[model samples]
Target: MKPGLELGNTAAITAKVTPDMYAQFEGQIVHRAYSTVSMVYHMEWAARQIILPYLEADEEGIGGGVTAKHVSPTAGGDTITATATVTGLKGRAVITAVEVHNGKQLVGTGEVTQYVLPRSEIEKKLASEQAK
Candidate 1:
């Protein structure tokens, strides 16, 4: 966390839907629209961007938790705008409210929590695990 990190800080990103974002796998068509997994990833991307600039040089944001819903289908070639707003802070964690829209339609919404950790601490933990 850093000074000036507060509620209402927002970040938004836009991306055009593509074949890869659709719910097709193994050449099987489960659906012909944006997937819930894609919505979660895009939502996290927007939330992370909002929290990054406030982190210290030694700190990195990691995904903590996310609860999301896919409410509507987004066709390929349609552009979606994902937005995140900081709503709360718990110690070193940031709580963000996220939403996705395709033009005037609401496609998805969620709450995401991101934890800021020292990069060195993560590497140290990995090294300790590897040593076992």
Candidate 2:
């Protein structure tokens, strides 16, 4: 949970683009631009996998922040890969740097902030507030 703890640690996740994931805008041309490249979702999936293992069963995680830039466009049938590195930890929150790539090109890169909390504790607190 330190700044350098995640520096060299890396995890990779893969996602395949399918026709069902494509977006169809009304009156717009349905092209590769409308396809869900799978890179965007892959990045989030990798981040969660990297952070969730460190949490307890009763704990829940929320994405507090994300700074990402989509660089390239990928088409359907292409497989995207996402990698996440833990860069730092602030209290119960873990800061990570993520990158998504399609074959040889980088599709996206960014940082994510995730918070860890006990699920039961959070629900109980909400219930108490509602009862007040």
For residues 12-51, write the lDDT of model 2, one tens digit per residue.
8887766654545664547654143345456667888777
The list of candidate 1 runs beyond 4 A from truth reads 129-132
TM-score to true structure, per model: 0.91, 0.77
Model 2's lDDT to the true fold?
Answer: 0.72
Mind sharing the TM-score for model 2?
0.77
Q: How do the residues 15-71 of candidate 1 rate in per-residue lDDT, one tens digit apiece? A: 998888988778776877888888999999999989878889998888889999889
Query: In model 1, where is the ten-residue run with the lowest total lDDT?
Result: 24-33
Rate residue 126 of model 2 by lDDT. Answer: 77
lDDT (CA) per prediction: 0.90, 0.72
Model 1 TM-score (2 dp): 0.91
